[model samples]
Target: MRTQVAIIGAGPAGLLLGQLLHAAGIDNVILEQRSGDYVLSRIRAGVLESGTVRLLDAVGAGARLHAEGLPHDGFDLLFDGARHRIDLAGLSGKHVTVYGQTEVTRDLMELRAGQGALTVYEAEKVALHDFDGDAPYVTYLDRGEQKRLDCDFIAGCDGYHGVSRASVPSRALKTFERVYPFGWLGLLADVPPVSHELIYAGEERGFALCSMRSNSRSRYYLQCALNERVDDWSDERFWAELRRRLDPATAEALVTGPSLEKSLAPLRSFVAEPMRFGRLFLAGDAAHIVPPTGAKGLNLAASDVHYLSEALREHYAERSSAGIDAYSTRALARVWKAERFSWWLTGLMHHFPDHDGFGGRIQQAERAYLISSPAAMTALAENYVGLPF
Candidate 1:
């Protein structure tokens, strides 16, 4: 098979990149190791930054999102049992939309199906071949048969564990990573959200987040030991922790439903230098990953595709590789900025047991300063809400 771009992985990054390139009359193929059902049903990031929303809207992918997603003007920062609302709208004139990653994947999958784009799922041994050479290929096993796909370029939109990053030479790539001492045990419930806005709680026990997926369903998370097991947490135990973190003032009827899903995500900060190497380019989690505290994962993936798509479009239009050549440096600038923000947010909200009283005091002072100073607040709001691509 041949295409202008052979994209590895059918995640949001690859799907959106294909869509953007398709609109610009570029040919691309997406390969995935999982079935379409698994890809669409995977529980992932829910929050979408303003820039992401606009990009989806521009591509006609926001119709369902606009109708079904909840828009919040701001979020609440809870500390010492006090709630401080950061007016996202008032601060940046932009708001975030609460729609699950599954929904976005479903929407894009439907769109791609209708268009008859080349998408192969449940493929195995998906490896990038000759990525350092001018003619790079993607070799995978489809239906027990090995297939080789030749393309002008290869995009590694696969997640952290995928083969894209591994294809790069260790000497050429500089890896930076910081793993947190804690992880988040996220839960999806059938109950309505306890609050109107997303609530981020910083307590002595740990950090907690109250977010919504829909009017009837709520998504919540609590910080726990990095090695904690989901089997250790019972339904009653989960609610107890949530109640303590959320601390509902009134006796609102709290109904506990069967947890549709639960998982532990270890917090970490990672970035690989030079997102591009020869004809192979990396995007999304393949290039960088941020702790989920700032809700930047999905948006960061979208931002990468937005920039890469534009670069590829320019390459096709002008028949110049300048845009493609500069892809890594351009994308890394934004990637690092987001990395700092995610790290800062995670450090401020999460209580590290190893940190002493002075460390806690420093975090508190930072949060206080963020809320008090307009410049600091604006910076937070700008990064949280998102910047224009």
Candidate 2:
């Protein structure tokens, strides 16, 4: 098989890239080791920055998002038995759309199918070859048959543990990471959220986030020890624990129900430097990861796609390698800024196991100052709404 670009992974990053490339008259094929249904089944965070929403619109995947996605002008930060609102729109002239990542992927997938794009699901044992040279290709097993795909370039959107980043020789890649001591135990239910706007609660007990997929579906999370097991916590126990971390009035308004899904996600910030390696480029989770506190995961991926698609378009249309040569630098600049924000928010919101008395007081003081000072709130709001892409 031959194409202009061979994309690994059919997740949002890969799918979005394919759409943008196709729209620009570039031919690309997406290969995924998982089935389409399996891709849609994975639950993920979905706070869409204004820029991400614009990309979806450009690819004709924003219709359902605009109709059903909830737009929030601000969110409440609860700490020290008080809740303060950060005016994202007023402070930053931008707001975020609350939509599930699964929904975004589904939209992009359906759009790609309607456009007659090729996405080879269940393409097992996928491998890249000669990406560091002038010619690059991919090989994989399809229904027990080996197949090779030749392409002008390769996009590794398969994620952190995927083959793209792993394909790079260890000496060629430099990695940075911070794995938090705690994880988030999250529950998804059909019940309505306690409030229309999301609430981030930082309490003596732990950190808790009240988010939603829709008016009828709510997703909630609690800070948990790394050793905590989902099987050990029933729906009732999860609700009780969440209540303990919320302010009295907010807790009183909480509604509980049977969970649609439950899982524990560890917190971490990671980045693989110089996102490009010859003809092979890494995007999305293949390049970086952020703790969910700042809600930067999917948005960050979208930004990566933005930079990559533009670079590829320039390479094809203008016959220039400048954008491609500069892709890593541009993407990483935004990636590190986001990493810092997510790390800072995670530290401020979650209880550390070994925080000394003085450290706790300092954290408290910072939180108090953030609410009272417009400058601090403005900085939070700007980052929360997203920095310019």
Model 1, residue 386: distance off in Å is 0.7
lDDT of 2 by residue, 1-389 (tens): 99999999999999999999999999999999999999999999989999999999998999999999999999998998988888899988999999999999999999999999999999999999999999999999999999999999999999988999999999999999999999999999999999999999998899999999999999999999999999999999999999998999999999999999999999999999889999999999999999999999999999998999999999999999999999999999999999999988888888998899998998988898888899999999988988898
lDDT string for model 1 (1-389, tens) is 89999999999888988899999999999999999988877898789998888878776789999999999889988887777888888889899999989999888888888899989999899988887888889899999999999998999999999989998889999999999999999999898887878888888889999888998998889999987999999878998887777556711445567798899999899999989998899999999999999998889899899889988999999988888888888888889899999999899888898998899889989988877888887788888988777
Superposed by TM-score, candidate 1 places the C-alpha of residue 26 at a distance from the truth, in angstroms, of 0.4
- Local error of candidate 1 at residue 237 (angstroms): 0.4
Model 1 RMSD, rounded to 1 decimal: 1.3
What are the clash counts of all predictions, listed in order?
A: 0, 0
Which pairs clash in model 2? none
TM-score of 2: 0.99
Off by over 4 Å in 2: none
